[model samples]
Target: MADSTGKTDKDVAPQIQATDVQVEKRASDDESAEKGVFEHINLNKNISARIKNPLADLSPAQVLRDVEEFANEHGLVDVLPALKKGALVARDPDHYESVPDMTPEDLTTIDDEVTHKWRQPRRLYFTIILCSIGAAVQGWDQTGSNGANLSFPDALGIPEKDNPNAARNQWLVGVVNAGPYIASACLGCWLSDPVNNYFGRRGAIFGSAVFCFIAPIGSAVCQTWPQLFITRLLLGLGMGLKGSTIPIFCAENTPAAIRGGLVMSWQLWTAFGIFLGFCANLAVKDTGDISWRLQLGSAFIPAVPLLIGVYFCPESPRWYIKKQRIKEAFESLRALRNTELQAARDLYYIYSQIKVEREIAGDGNYVTRFIELFTIPRVRRATLASGTVMLAQQMCGINIVAFYSSTIFEKANATVTEALFASWGFGLVNFLFAFPAIFTIDTYGRRALLIFTFPQMAWTLLAAGFCFYIPTESRAHLACVALFVFLFAAFYSPGEGPVPFTYSAEVFPLSHREVGMSWAVATCLGWAAVLSITFPRMLAVMTPTGAFGFYAALNVTALVMIFLWVPETKQRTLEELDYIFAVPTRIHMRYQAFKVFPWWCQKYILRRNVTLEPLYKFDGVQTRGDNRAVKE
Candidate 1:
């Protein structure tokens, strides 16, 4: 400035220096601003590129991570958060815009809101409670038959202690007791898909409730073992339908956040039913002929409530969506969720997933669709996982305890009175331990629970078997066997008992959900049939110790299958699991063990600042196709 105005040389030099400093500062600021602009542009471009071709060279874990980061950068949240901030709203009366494409993370976020909302005492909980009443009937039917075994033989004119036809009588007992499972496996499983597809989840459940009512009444009136067997066979048809449909209903209607617990409530109530059955048996054990009849008839109580209540319950929104009854789906969702925004969000996610599924299915017939379970690698994996878990549940010998606990106690040298009371203890343990799963299942995840508990179950079964080696006259031996049996129940209730049903409910895609569940349930019934038919003979042949050992071996096998095959399904949307299983089997087989420990440590011990990136990656080609049809 001084140079231009013709000032002194010293003044001009100082002015020049100040000008230089200001110019340098301005240039540096310009450079930093340009750098920020470039960095932002790069980040946005990267995200867009990933979205455009999501499956291109990305692992399933990487895809999940990228989608989550994208949601965060865009200021996304789940249903509750969006609703509180007014980011989500119902469509205008005149014109409606389609919902935008959502990642599985976004879908799961919406599910979280619905779940949190349902946790309050609301219509959703009421529906779950009502639907679960059928499960109580199932439990009652199961243990009621076990209690009847105490006296039904004599009532049927079969010998009590020293019959020469003990083998034939044993066969009669097993066939009558397992008649339902046999019917379920052979006929009911085949019918489940068609029934659900034709009648919808609510209709299927209602029909089952009716059959449950009729079957138990028939059993109470039956005069012959053969007549009782036919009634049980009819009951099995009802059970098969309920088993396949109820879990699907609960899963489709409830929020994914609490879906595990709610669907698992089926098992919880089943435990309660077992408790009721034991109490009923205690009340009638001393009665001569009426004891067995009354025990069989008691099943009618829960069925009445189930039949009446399920009629008033909302149908699964997913079923409505599948039928393309979009308006009804929205209404059903609204009834189940807290707000219109939540319902809309859920509908958006569900619709997107259904579209993807239909595209894959391509107007296939029922037989073709059923065959797809095996032909499609991803779905086949799901089928295998579900079936294996069900098989494992049966083979672990929980039913052995459930069906013959009184006999087991007798074998342990307890009197009839003591055995009946001890049976009550077994039922109590089964009921009490199921509560922990209600709390921990969504938090700890399914795989972790299986891993932790399977080993414990194996140990307990083995110990119980070994305890039988001590003389039956030894009170200490009897006590040890009883303690081990109780411990087995404790481990099983929280893990295998509930996980199989819940996990199977979740694994299948909406397209094949009913059929897939049917197959899974069939596997359960098939195994149950084999065990029920053989266990009495097994008891006569192998004795209690050898039978327990066989169960222990099965548990060990189950543990291995779980470690190798099952993935962590916590906090994931049902659609997200498709990608998870799409990961190559070889990669999972190699890295599974190392992946297990860190996941457990992070959730249980680390508590903060834990990274789980390495646990999910492997050196393998990405098998998931570039199916970004939802984005369009």
Candidate 2:
């Protein structure tokens, strides 16, 4: 039978057997050589030979040229197969390349194994759960502060009802509460790279957990708004670290088939934390002075288990490989994967990619590494995609509802008690809608979801805004506003909510992942800071109707950006993305609608007679359907 690449079993089997015999003969010769009085000397020579690093001496361009020359001279179909069969090795004696187990059909088998092993092992599930809890703590902080803001004004002597300084106090409320995003944008973004590089993923998480644990207690006991603001700012630092680390940690560890959904658990648990925060508000809304403090302090509760549990989880195998702790990487992969073969295959892929990246990056410093994001075409495309998704996520106005829902409800003429309960309902809708993403994100793809749901979100925001034109005190108007808010959550939750985090996490190569994710998170927090600082003023000047209309316009802009730029990543291994982004911009945009629209329509609306395939594939040197091979 022919394999997926159309080579028959008979045509491939003998070559594989020949390669195996050659490898075995080499091993036998080496073993025979080591059995003499000169054995220790021979061993030392072998060790020295194996210690040389190919990437240290070669430029990326030179390496690429050498690989192409080697392939051509050997008449090889692909570099990987030759490398696997021991036909290709670095010229220097000290450079090492682990030969993967080979059959002539090994490539096809590897692809099949990757697909079959798509489901991660149970230990990986524990890692996902641990990272998800860190995300929940972040989520808890997001809406937990919203709840506390409601009562803290009264308890802390800030002006509210008829005070002349109410406008200033409102601005202060927005700014102080927005401190986390600001801190994340400024310090957390830059810190994430070095912290992850030096401390490892688990260590960074532990540090964040300590900050998360302590900051909330300060918020709980602070008697003054300034004290509370300082505590919240510190909390933002922890959040910034968690925001940068957890998604990368999760994405690096997961199988490609479920990577999107697993990374998106960050947002899923964020919504859950918001739900818990809203419930806390309802529980304490009627209590006297301590209500807000207790609500804010409750964010600390999840950090305990997060700190303890993360210690037991495996470090990212990719990170271990990057650090050249090959033994640890192997053990970690074994711990997280279904079988030893699968682990070996994963290691082979990671090792190959790391070699290429090291040659390309060339012992660059952090600043040089950051500059490479813009200088490298594939890396630049990924950075732009990640940054745009994050910006779109913040501009979608989800945070307006998340952070200011209680105030918005009150503005609609619901009593404080009624508004707190209504906020709970809003949080519930968000939490419930997030569940659909877990099932659909991998199957339906990230770009399609963003395209399909964005316009729906825009329309709901417009309708919700128009609802405010009804008399403020009318029960019908209040119900209409609440209904539209719930609809907005429904539309936003399944797509835009999770796609940003997943897309950002998966886009960067292992070499630049931490810095890339940090930049993406910084984009998210920077825009969030803009929204949080401005939403109160916008609400005052433009009315709720006009503010919602403005956000609706931003959603339309985001839709245009996504359509023009973002590529489908579903079912593609993270390594394959190098080729995906290499597709020229004009070609990608021209074909994007054909790729994204049919899938969205069939899955959500039509449900029949649709066949979907990846927009691009690499066959030997060629990109399928395109005449020219993609040169990397």
Give one clash count per candidate, in the order shown. Answer: 0, 3
lDDT of 1: 0.73
Q: How many residue-pair clashes does candidate 2 contain?
A: 3
User: Model 2 TM-score?
Assistant: 0.79
Q: List the residue pairs that clash in candidate 2.
A: 49-93, 49-94, 52-94
Error of 2 at 380 (Å): 1.3
Error of 1 at 147 (Å): 1.3
Q: TM-score for every candidate vs. truth?
A: 0.79, 0.79
Write model 2 residue lDDT over 129-189, tens digit each, in one string.
8878887777787777788767888777785568888888878888877888898888876
What candidate 2 gets wrong by more than 4 Å, as runs, is 1-119, 593-615, 620-632
The lDDT of each candidate is 0.73, 0.74
User: Cα deviation of 207 in candidate 2 (Å)?
Assistant: 0.8
In the order shown, the candidates' Cα RMSDs to the true structure are: 14.9, 11.8
